[model samples]
Target chain A: MSPQSSVLYDAPGPRTRRRTTIAAVLIGVALLAGAYYLVYRPLEAKGQFTAVKWGPLVDLADPNLPLVWERIRLGIIATLTAAALAIVCSLLAGTLLAVVRMLLKEQAKRRYAGLPAAAAYALRGLNTALRGITRFCVEVFRGLPVLVTIFFAWRISGISDPLWPLVIGLSIYNSVVIAEIIRSGMEGLPRGQREAADSLGLTPFQAILLVQLPQAFRIMLPALISQLVVILKDTTLGYIITYEDILAVAQQMIQILQNPIQMYVIIGAVFIAINYALSQLAAYVQRRVSRVRAHKPAAAATELAASEPVVLDA
Target chain B: MDVLIDNADVFVSGFWLTLQLCVLSATGALLIGTIVAAMRISPVPSLRWAGATYVTLVRNLPLTIVFFLTSFGLPELGSNADFLRVPGLSSVFDRLGIDLPYFRFAVIALSVYTAAFVCEAIRSGVNAVPAGQAEAARSLGLTFRQNLLSIVLPQAWRAAIVPLGSVIIAMIKNSALAGAFGVTGELFSSGQNLTSSGGNPIIPVFIGISIGYLIMTVPLGIFIDRVENRRAVAR
Candidate 1:
């Protein structure tokens, strides 16, 4: 409202103000009624609100009561396990892909200077073919839903554990998105940094490693974390292929308890809790990075950040 | 290849249904998303809170989980089926021979999922509107709604087309999840049927589907980019 305060309409006059208040009140009431009818009434009618169905929740301390706590506990571990593996793999894969993409760009700008004609010709052919392959892989993975990739990977991976399929699927898909984030992050940096490193006799690889990657990683931290949260949420897709994740446990409970409402609500809450924490960590990192960057008058908040690369998850 | 040819009908129907779910839900998500976006920018605090809460709640949960809630939970409410049995409504579905229950919940799930993303994109668009434009609208004595409708949103939508198109592609991908939940005739379910038909067709079948999706999505991205570049040039 501060920047957005339009001078177009004056502050509503008393009558108009009253009308706005009334309309707001009506909307609030309608929302409440809509929620009650759409959600509450249906739940209540099915006896889902009753203590007997929800009673198992409170019996955690009672040793006599059998519970799926162990499964749920294992499910949490499994989800984290998949997320951790996928995060590492995607980061490595993304970095490699980003480097290759940068190579493609550099090759396009190649000058044939200081090279043998045959060597130059070979490099050009290799560059085009490499570009073509990487571009297709990235586009295919990015275009297809992660769910389909997971399904395909699960079937064709021919691995014993379902875990490998989910992790690989999540990695290949997310690596493309993360690569974009990395590439954009590097592009946003002042060319001066790399040029200065080169003037100091740093090799291109040394300049990139010592000077550029750190800056790009810092700039891309917020985006990287969001993609990680995407990876986290995507582990739920593991459940569809019957991977032992939190969602699968939640689904299993419904068959036993006949409480899809309560079960799904519980599952949804767990996901919200985990994802909220991850995003909060991301928010904290962004704030810290921005604060430090602000101290140095860095133009780190580039327009590239605004072009959010869509996260593809399995 | 022969496996693909043999199951050609299944793939066709699946692609058709995937397209249907994608289009319908994208439309629904856009409408509801616009309203939610409006609520966020409204002068009223309560409406803003409601809009913010909806986005947070929906965006935080995965679409698969949302589908689980819709397909499993909504049916427990019983009204979903009862509504289909309503006097005049049941007849329309009957004439069309659509299984109202599964289709309704799938659409609901997809809309409920995609709408949060659509809201974010449109809200970003709203934010992108120059302050001067809003000021100009206000100076001309335009009401809040009038300024939004006539001045801000028109510009916003143009800025929004690319992001919104990305959301549509994501929704198309997500429709495969509905097939997971027993919604018949989408690529995921068709792939499942093909798999059970035996011999690692899961590879060829889903690879074909991935190719199908790429064909659908890549063109969308290109078209949007073309328009976006043209718009930029015009500006």
Candidate 2:
């Protein structure tokens, strides 16, 4: 359509382009292989490779495996606690923020049209500053590695064991993401719905809570579910803080028992099960929500129709 | 302050090693992931199953566990340690004069773990591409690969970049876990050297390591977000 488009279409003959692309890919693969050989072959030659030892892994059944079970239990406890905290805190914080902003928007619309120009400018400035602060906070939290944040929290005065720091860090970081999802969901609501609610004499709080929040939640459920999954997986970062998450337990098992690889495989299976289960649950909830929402009007109308006979008989 | 300044040289070397491992492994995983993504979308049922299984396995598993599999488990299998038996392979490898066992293990682990998410991201990216684009390419007599490379991938890559970038950032962060492997080649000798020293300030040491990770992860995150924003604007 444009000169650039034509140039792109004409730049290389198709045959030449195909050959170059394939060649580039092949060369890249070969370079990776060569690099691997250069770095890994020598390490493999070391005694790092030993015959399969099942004894240490099997010894897990023995009651004397004190730290092993403690590590595993503590890790699971920490991960679950962190996940629950993040979800609850983020949902509450994000919803409150979204409601406050939406309320401010309605007030602005009502107050601004008749305002003097100077007052309008002041109002606009205040709005801009609020949005700016929200963005800055989100960027700062999201920009930092969750692990760094957790480490910072652990080092900062009050918190003791690594679990609290991890949970607090997760909550702060994930709240930003949750807030964004909420803001976007609020924006997605049709203007007509807002006008309809206003015309019905509904208060701003009533309209948002009764008319809007339900719909927004439905729209955002998928994102929220995926965020939960992310947070769940992110719990693995606890291993760094010595919080005894699944990975930490695996690390302890590997180090104390000296069967590093086998234990790792077992740990991997544990994480897979946890995450896969979460994903499946998310899919189930999504389907359930959609189906219920789809039938809402029909179900409501059917109930109304069924009640009409009783009203007439009475 | 004096100790930190004294250790600046080790810190810089560690930074370089971190970059090397992250970039190399990210690239390797991206390649494997792209292939798996293709397989996930392939017509063959077996390929699709393989892709699905791989994505499920890697996406769910803790990356450290995968790293362990590479660093320690492979040797137990016996096959992983065997010398190159390819025609003229051993001689060529020798001529290059490279020793790469640790590199290979790291690459394998990082790539396999990364590929799972890559598959998910790329699959979603492909899903985002309108069916019309593929139809247009096919109408032009482009074969499957050509259609994929020309029409689907570029568009899908745009959609895929955010999640893929997140996964890459995850890999970089997870690269710090390499310290736990007792591998000397890793970037942060944090877990080992700190624990071994026993008296060193653990907080500063960890904070320093965190800063190092921030240096690696933060910029990529900004870039990816920027790219995603641009794509949003374009669409």
Candidate 3:
């Protein structure tokens, strides 16, 4: 009904308006009937809608409610702990890998001045080899499914603690993804960012560390937050390795309560709530970043400083 | 190495199932996604809200939970609503010799989950079409559907191809979850079975499995990059 959406068609006349109302009513009724038949009736017939089935999770008067909450609280703490560890590890490793790969690429392209010809050739070979190795690792990690990576970590790495394997696996895969995100962010910057750094007499490494990376990170903050949500979601995979995360704990509760549907619904709701909040934050940050870039370009440095800690808190 | 060479058929069949899951799920996602996209942009406010609600709910829920709901929860609902039991459709699948209900459930889960991403990709594509293009089409006395099909969607599809490819590639990776949830013979479960039952070395079995996924994903990655680069050049 907005003017913007109306761009696709003309404003409705009286006859068109009547037709639209009739169509909308019919569609809405059909949708309601479909939902009733597909979801409500089936669930009702199965006794899933009974208060007894939902009492453990929702009813305060239930005797087992406190114990259930305790388990869920601990499960949430465990999931967050793993997610935090993975987020920290991946951010650091991803930044390092991105910088090192960038440096190695520059090294491969640069001529070694005032060096022996043989030494220069050998250095070039080393640069190329390092770059190749870096590329290989990134590709391999990015290509493999995170579950397989987690499985490998759990099985082959001799890590007895379930949390470490989950953390290590998530960190590896997510670090590679973050590195690519950072690399693309840097690439998206105007050429002047690099040229200005060079004109200021900074070495390639120093320029990248001091100048290019900060801007890239700032530009890619929304992506980084979204990836954090991914890490949080993936921590649930620890259930496979028996890691006592929220989902795993939910399964344990189901054994005693015999309410798999209620438990999973609660668990799913928790995840959806958390992830939806994170994604909304990402969208908010994206909007703010673009606004900051658009207006008052001169104050961007201070604005960037102000915004940094808010994202890091996640 | 010898382990992989001896179990070549296992790996082959595993990857084949993975490929089939991807193809079927991708098709379903595309069909459902297109309809959702249409609904999201339709003139009806209720339809728009419905589309938005669907995308938000599905996108936020983890795929594992979606799989759990479809595979375990559907059966518990006691509905005789087997989607494959439609009059003529069951016969087509019967002819193809693929009749695992769990496999069908996995496909349902995957298609439903991945369709959210596909819907977002298409909406982005629609946004990429200029306002003037739609206005021009409307001024020429074209209906909304005609304007969308002739003017908007063609350009949108072109703009959407790179993102759609990435979505498909992600779906391929996600199909790994199907193996764990009970759809056997996929790459992940095959690796799991080989290591656990066959007593093969975990490293080699996993390595073989990773190779199968890379075979599916890496080439697609390259193709996406090439298409993206070509688009950039065209622009």
Best by DockQ: 1
What lDDT does the true structure give each of the candidates? 0.77, 0.65, 0.83
lDDT of 3 by residue, A2-119 (tens): 3436778888899988888888888889999998998888888888878877898999999888989999999999999999999999999999999989888878777898899999
The residue pairs that clash in candidate 3, if any, are none
Tens-digit lDDT string for candidate 1 (B133-223): 9888888888887988799889889878877887888788778788877677777777876786555456678776876677788998789
Q: What is the lDDT of residue B34 in candidate 3?
A: 89
Query: DockQ, in order, for the candidates?
Result: 0.56, 0.16, 0.50
Best by lDDT: 3
For model 1, the stretches where C-alpha displacement exceeds 4 angstroms are A1-19, A58-66, A287-314, B81-97, B200-202, B228-235
By summed lDDT, which 10 consecutive residues of candidate 1 chain B come out lowest? Answer: B89-98
DockQ of 1: 0.56
Question: Which candidate has the top score in TM-score?
Answer: 3
10 residues in a row with least lDDT, candidate 1 chain A: A305-314
Pairs of colliding residues, candidate 2: A38-B99, A38-B100, A39-B100, A39-B101, A40-B100, A40-B101, A40-B102, A41-B100, A41-B101, A75-A244
- lDDT per residue for candidate 3 within B1-235, as digits (tens), equals 8999999999998998888778878888999988998898898767888899998888888888888888768887673236645566545443123555777787788999999888878887777778899999998999998998999899989878877887888788888888888778888999989988888988889889999999988899899899989987897
